[model samples]
Target chain A: MISKVGRHSIRLVSELGELAGFSGKASVALPGQRHIMEKLTRSIFEIGVRCVPITLIVGLFTGLVLGLQLYYVLTKFSSESLLGQAVALSIILEIGPVFTAIMIVGQAGSALSAEIGIQRNAEQIDALHTMQINPIGFLVSPRLWAAIIAFPILTTFFDLIGIYGGYLTGVELLGVDPGAYWNRIYEAVSVQNIVNGLLKALVFGIVTTMICAFQGYYTHLKSDIPGARGVSQTTTRAVVYSSIAILMFDYLITSFQMAS
Target chain B: MSEATTLKLRGLKKAFGEQVVLGGIDMDIPLGSHTTVIGKSGTGKSVLLKCISGLMAPDAGSIAAGDEKGAPPCSYMFQQNALFDSMTVEENVALPLREKGKAKATEIKKRVSDLLEQLDLTAARKKYPAEISGGMKKRVALARALITNPEIILFDEPTTGLDPQRKYSVFDMIRSYRKRFGFTVIMVSHDVPEVFEISDKIAWLDAGEIKYWGTPDDLLANPPEDLKPFLNPQLSPA
Candidate 1:
């Protein structure tokens, strides 16, 4: 049992090291990549524009549910006026970044992983290498850059839509004063809070995109199976690992922010 | 290496864990010649080609260009064609030049246009790989391979899944292109007698080594004893 654990630990470390190196190489290649703006624009269209509807929908529903739940709880303590403050903080500090990331992972990240995994299986990556082209630059760098630029913007959209949904539930449905809801939210959510939330979005974006790209890029080497099955395995792992990384980083960043 | 040689492989070796692939391969490929390496499945023919193409590093020995400027410019045509499924034929064909970023847009456009027309792929230039027929895909792959005008081209099972007619057509395409471009060709193929038609020389790889290296006629007339069963399965004793 100990040996098995040790083996797994070593494998995890090795994979992490490889992931770090892959991320560094892709980041370094971005500035020098040919036709950078064109690739970056395409990637933004894929990861940002295509993902807008889902983000708005999920954000709206999350706010409604939070407002409904927190309304009843606050009424028990005669603190129903705090509904806006509660909803705003929860959406900004946690739900906005996390759920937006999860939604993007489901919609865009999976497709990216699968596309790259299939490319690896087809020897397209090897063909690039033979042509004296760096596959990481051609494939991953633009997506990374897109994630960095898009995630914060998407999270901002989510937070706004979610706050409005909370107003719809807290004031329109629950018969709370609309002025109180707006006033509490206005006073409670500081610039630092928004900055902190955007920071989380940026981190989540980089981590998730890197994980997804790494899994697909090394699908052949990392997977025990071969061909289509191998691509499928790595893509599944990409989503699962990215989700876990999001939560883990959420905790670490939250803790660090609180400490600071 | 003589001036006539394009590639010189001396004691090339590779292994995956305990299974040795190319134990120690030695061969000299003549300039502007088509040399096909034939072997049974899992015999490291592709591995040797990968090593020579620098896709995979050899565990031992040296693969040297005939001229002493180090490795020659080379392109690979994978068995699956390896065309970027997302990119149209024109984009796929022009990718290498675009990535290299040396040529201006006009030069790249002119080269891609000329090659696509030469390969009869002009009509399919805007089509994705999935939109084209197998023969057309092969032609597109060849166009992409030749777009760079490299001194050497490596083909790994260039006709693996094709019907007999398509296989022959692919061989003819390779032969005609090799003649037109004057590039050295190193192909790994399983198609036996069909491959012989386009090959200037045949190298039979077995058990991680080249067992026979000679002209097609020599291989047919006096194939090595172990290679006979592979070359002519019907003639071998049941």
Candidate 2:
């Protein structure tokens, strides 16, 4: 099963590289990317802006759980103060970005894939080609840049809400002083840590969008063609491929950091 | 309609791997003429159309327009109406304007609105492709073709899967549109009689060669005994 999953991951990346290869060359300006800005703005409104309330709720509950759980474990060492650092590190470095990426993939990524795949299968892509418009520009670039911009914003929200939840659990539930807890959190969570987490969030964004778009556009037997089942399959493949990719990349980056 | 003046094909050949689709085709379409090329199911008719539209390039031979070297930018209509589902009917219709030259939004809208109304699709101007019928989709395809006001427009099997009356209506639309715009129409069709009705000339393409190229009148008068079986049903090859 592990080997098969690895192969699938490689297969997906290979497909994406091949499909977007043409665009990479046809593209004159990486900075001149047109649709990406619009995509980022729209995604910020939809995924980041609209998702704020839910993200806060989820973040708060997650922080509370971490604090409560760590309280028991750290009690053995009489290290209750570690609660702040623990919660901060977990939320900032790991949970926040991963959780949010998974969420967006479920919400927007798969839907985008299905829609584009169906358009491709339906011959709308071919129609665009006939007219000499790049399908990647017309479709893929916006979604990619949007995710890159939007994920980091959402991850920041996740981290903040989670820290607040940690505060609630550390002060209200535990006998820790509220003043002490806030002080520890502020002192323990440095700028470098926050930046690291944001960097991860940005990478996660690119991965989620690229894998979804690539899977959607290339999973089909051919391009510029449309069918209902073909689109469904495309959506399914996109979600699966992206989820696996996120996990694999997480492992590689984390391991690289550890080794370094 | 084979005119000697515009859109000439000389020894056009296309191949996929070793499988040659169009071995060699030589023909001339007159200015503002409708010539329907008829053939059996897989006799490279669509490939020939694709070559003319620049959708597919020929391996050898030249496709020229207006007694010149390069083809004047032409429009192609697919067998499937390749409309952008994300865009509305009017937006889809006005797409060619973006390609030819940038036009003011107001001007593009006006041109799109006129085409939509003419096709009797003004009611569904805001509707998506999924909201419309196949016939309407075909008509939208027609609208998109006419949008660019291309010098040459090629339709790939224009009336495939329509009801008989709708097929006739599409055929009639093809005829009237050709008359109105005065652009050359090179269409691929199975409806031989219908093609004969609108086509100024007909090319009987069989087994990768043109058996005959002449006016429709000449075709009826000198119908090949061998092709009669393929042209009409309930007939056997001689």
Candidate 3:
């Protein structure tokens, strides 16, 4: 029994190694110029175009809430007017990256995982390999490139809408001075803060999409199992892992920024 | 029975955590040949195909193509059409070519049209896989496989779950296309006699080993009761 268990351990490691090698081969096998165009268009449709209205709606509400909440709390300190800086800092640094990524994990990441997983289960990836078409180039690279390009842009959009919402609350609703609000926000927020937030979003996008894709792609490793249980497990694990990873990464990045 | 293409698999082995799927498989899938592998369910017929296609690499053994690269890209027709539910029949057929950029949009559309016409699925081209019938879905998969003008096509239980009419029709389609294209057709199926009709050689796999490998007539006359079950499996779906 002991020997049998030992043998199994060795076998699992070897399979994992092979999978890694295959993944590496796939990553290097890039699509042609035209295929890249199609992938880019698809990414725009999936990540940017489809995500815009949702991001705007969500971002705006979050900003408005942040402003209202901050105004109520800072009123005790005779600083209700500081609502502008509070909302801006929160949206620009924390809420924008985290909330946007989680939202995308639901929207884009889930879609990506489901699509790639179904393909893997259906043997389409195998078909690609047999055809000498690199599945990585055909599947993974487009997604990697898309997340790298789209997430930062999406995060920026989220931040903008959120700030606008907070601005609306502070100026139109709360009767805080507009000039004072912008001045406070501009004074507290710097280019480095913006860069840090955008960078976090970019990294989160890649990590979230990749984990989901990998989970989906390797799902059929447990072949012969009936039902969508495997798919369910993969999707759940993807979200959980991605969220934890994003948080861990967020702290590290913030620390780096603070130190430097 | 032998053909130009040579796919050599030596010391081919694969295993799950505690289960050994393909113990040690040595096979040659030649070009211009119709080889059908019959085995019990869960006996790794599909796994063997996956290994050969490089979808699931075996723990041991090496699969190498003796033919030239881009010698008609080998297309795999999965047991279940494996159609992208999202894409139209035309898009599904165009998938590989679209990825490879082997043809312009006009040419792709043209080729897709021709395939649809040939398979009598022209009217269904705009429909998604879910919207189409199971038989139609299988045909769409076949169309997709043919779209690449493959060097060889590996089919996993090509007619496993179809109705009688669709099953025989699928058989006819598989045979006629192989003749027309002169491409190697390697199929892993349990449809015993139907496979025999199309197969130039038969390899009966049992428990991760090739128990029997010969021509249909050779096996029929000197019948093994072991292979008899596969000789006439219920064509109806389970």
Candidate 4:
């Protein structure tokens, strides 16, 4: 009999192999431009359009809190003029991408998992296979590409709103000179910083959606769970795993940038 | 003997770990004929169909189709109907055509509408799978399977969970369509008498093998010892 650690190691290796294979296959299973357009539009509506109001609200509140907190911290060092710089840096470098990713994983990723899981249970995936349709290309790749397109757009919206929220708190509420605030923010944030945040969002979106879709695809293959119970558990696990993957990859990418 | 052997299974074997499902199965499904496979639960009835349909590979043995050069398109109507809940009835029927890209959108729409009408599912064409009844779902699945104009159609207990009337209606629909399409039909079923009515041949699987293969009359007139109890339960000292 294999030891407990050995069994777990085998399972982990198997999962990693499956992830690699699925990513490779999905990359090549390109749908036609017309098919892509149809899928992407529906996906953007579900994943991006629906999350706008909540993301906007969250961005504004997070920026307001960050600005108020930073003012007091900087005031002690006679550097309250740096309030905009701090808030802008945090939003662009970390908060915008990370928050948007978490939101997408919660909203879109969970639903994707549940939808695919139900399809699997209902034998719809097998039906597609029998019809000679590539189930991954039809069901999965569209969502992955859609998330890639949607994530950067959502992040841009989040950053702009967050910056405005910071401006409100710093210039209008805290009596920081509006000119100083605007000047510091403009000096602190560059095109590279905006591009970096967008890159993070893109990676996070791809990794999170891939994980969710993979989990959904393999839900029936999991022996320990079956039927509706498997569907529910897999949905929850998809959300949790995608969230953790986003944070972990975020740190890893940031570390790589820092080291380079 | 009149119909050619469209599908031939020889020494087909499959197992899950130590538990062997199909130890070795050999059978021939003739072209343009309806064949019913009857077996107790867990006897690998569906497994055999899966292997024949190329959905699952046999651990050992060969399944040779009539065409040695190319595989004729085949469709399987799953026991659960397997209709996409998100799609309307007509969309579900049109899926195979769209997937194959053999026809334009207008052509696909026309074919789907005609199929819906023929299947008496025109009223449900705009309704999603969830909005339809089990009988309607079965007919929808049949329309989807027939849309591709496949040479072989595998039915996995298509009428398993329906009332007696619904079951008979489904059988009637299959009979009428088979007369028109003349596709080879291989079905796994638990409904003995009803399925026998539509089947030209019957194969009874027991203990991981085809214990009997012949016409329904032959099976009733000369059943093997192992199958006697199953064929006539009243005679046994129960």
Best by DockQ: 1
- Once model 4 is optimally superposed onto the true structure by TM-score, how far is the C-alpha of residue A246 displaced, in angstroms? 1.0
Worst 10 residues of 4 chain B by lDDT: B64-73
Q: DockQ of all candidates, in order?
A: 0.88, 0.41, 0.48, 0.62
Candidate 1, residues B155-209: lDDT per residue as tens digits? 9999999998999999999999899988889999998888888999999999999
**Candidate scoring better on lDDT of 2 and 4:** 4
Chain B TM-score, structure 1: 0.95
Q: Calculate each model's fnat, 2 decimals.
A: 0.90, 0.37, 0.60, 0.67
lDDT of 1 by residue, A54-129 (tens): 9999999999999999999999999999999999999999999999999999888999998999999999999999
Q: State iRMS for model 3.
A: 2.6
Second chain alone, TM-score for each candidate: 0.95, 0.91, 0.88, 0.93
In model 4, the clashing pairs are none
On DockQ, who's better, 3 or 4? 4
List residue ranges in candidate 2 displaced over 4 A.
A1-61, A174-176, A222-226, A255-260, B1-4, B66-70, B98-100, B207-211, B234-238
The reply for model 3, stretches above 4 Å from the true place, is A1-34, A222-226, B1-20, B23-30, B56-73, B225-238
Off by over 4 Å in 4: A32-34, B1-4, B67-71, B234-238
- Count of clashing residue pairs in every prediction: 0, 9, 1, 0
Candidate 3 local lDDT, residue B211: 84
TM-score, first chain, each model: 0.99, 0.84, 0.87, 0.95
Best by lDDT: 1
Q: Model 3 over residues B69-111: C-alpha lDDT tens digits? A: 2123577888877777778999888887776765888998899
Most TM-score-accurate candidate: 1
Interface C-alpha RMSD, model 1:
0.5
